[model samples]
Target: MPKPLYQCRVLVTATSYGVHDPALKTTLESQVGEVVYNQSGRPFTAEELAALIPGFDACIAGLDRFDRQVIARADHLRVIARYGTGVDNIDLDAAREKGIIITNTPAANADSVAELTVGLILALARNIVVADRETRAGLWPRLQGISVNGKTVGLIGFGAIGRRVAQKLSGLGCQILAFDPYTDPASGEGLAHFTSREEVIASADFLSLHCPLTGQTRGMVDAAFLKSMKRGAFLINTARGELIDEAALIAALNEGHLRGAALDVFTRQPPGADHPLLAMPQVIVTPHMGAHSDHAANAMGWGALNNCLAVLRGEEPENRVV
Candidate 1:
């Protein structure tokens, strides 16, 4: 339709979307003229990306790094459409200097991520994993677990995902507290109430991170922060792995300063088999599937491909981050 809008040579680095739906690939091929694809089914490193991206006009990027070294070598890369909400993997300054348009599927998977966050909170509070494990092992074990109802739940950030979480938790009778200086207070109305960071850390029964991974936010949940949290509090993180200090979280759980933690993201993905956290009975972990529902995948794939097409057509992308 409409002459396919644009024409260029593109790389489809994120394999899930177009591969699952060939028509989507055909649509992208129609606009880009020729599209190369990544069949490896995983994210590529800087070196790998540098080698694969030089001749491409645009990329349907996943979590691959497009740093200065990679972007500097990209002789023809005009745009990058990030497959997910986060742009932390891409070096914004480098992309800007290289005149490469960077776009993300903002809020494309917000509902999915928010739902996962809530699920993690419940899993943490209810000892869901442990119970399931014990039952599967033929042991009738019962453990006392905290309930979310009437609990003081704290949100570290009030972005789209955080707001969605607050709205969902409201249905469960939780008193939500949000701490985000940059966020508009109106975002938390009815669902949550704006509060001071210290207050959230000191008072919440359950604490969840919904912030991005930035220089200021990386490793924000350190020893002092964990120590300040309410005793026997539970931590839920569906955000970036770098946001929390993993060792500190383990210490908090071991010392009984915190009850438990449910993590959908980790400091090291697919952490080593012998990782201490994996052996800990108080911890529950998932393979970072917060934004991975079929519905979300379709939306993200469509958004990422269209974003590249938009930039190729000399129009503003739907979610340009840089």
Candidate 2:
């Protein structure tokens, strides 16, 4: 009798909801001998992940903390398939050392995130949430909101999402100013580039963050940075939460220095129920749903899954991050 075709074990460390997707589960069972899944969205501890990873041939991961120790312990692990675009949550150097291929779905959620950025900008500028609350409470207090048209909008990053945002705002008749070290000065048709962050902040009526969270960018927007902005200018962050200094932002809003601010990401996930930012009427916060659109999620899952299958079949996936 021929031995059972191929004995393969797979592990999926994705957030709870995606694990229930019929397509994802069916694909895993069809290819592997055994499959384990983590339903919790929280990052798994190193020891917990290490113990479970030893025999898995592949892993479909989320924003979980997969450090060097976890990678080292996965002797049988071959590939890591990320469910989202950002790979900052994982340690790339460690995966490379283990000869494990790391892959992510880039541009899969560009439209969703770009749309969220635009929505957040409008929500904050117009005090949409606050106005609705007051109206519901029978108070007809008329609060004047700023308009996007004719506003000088500054974009800090000029990647796929950033470029899309620039296009959207430009169509709305806003002057676009962008700053990205990687962007070619002559590339964009109508976008202008500034030499310094201070210059952009000082001149713009609205500032939107689109950069990745890196060593140089973490907490880059602090008190001194906010102070340089034009008075009453609005701030929007759809990028990583750690990119801005939360304390400084609260102070700015409280002091009436900034007209308003919008955040789709936070320094801490689910930032405790009573988080200071939640109490402020001048700030708008969303539960990190920028890439949660069904279209984007489906693309991310299928793309990452296909990449894993390619690696298993000895073909290099086009989206390999490592």
**What lDDT does candidate 1 reach at residue 39?**
78
Which candidate ranks first by lDDT, i.e. highest?
1
Which residue pairs overlap in candidate 2's backbone? none
Report, for all candidates in order, the number of backbone clashes: 0, 0
TM-score per candidate, chains pooled: 0.95, 0.90
Error of 2 at 251 (Å): 1.7
TM-score of 2: 0.90
Per-residue lDDT of candidate 1, residues 217-264 (tens digit):
999999999999999998989999999999998899999999888888
Query: Tens digit of lDDT per residue, candidate 2, span 208-275?
Result: 99899889999999999999989899889988999999999999998989988888999988798899
Which run of 10 residues does model 2 get worst, by summed lDDT? Answer: 1-10
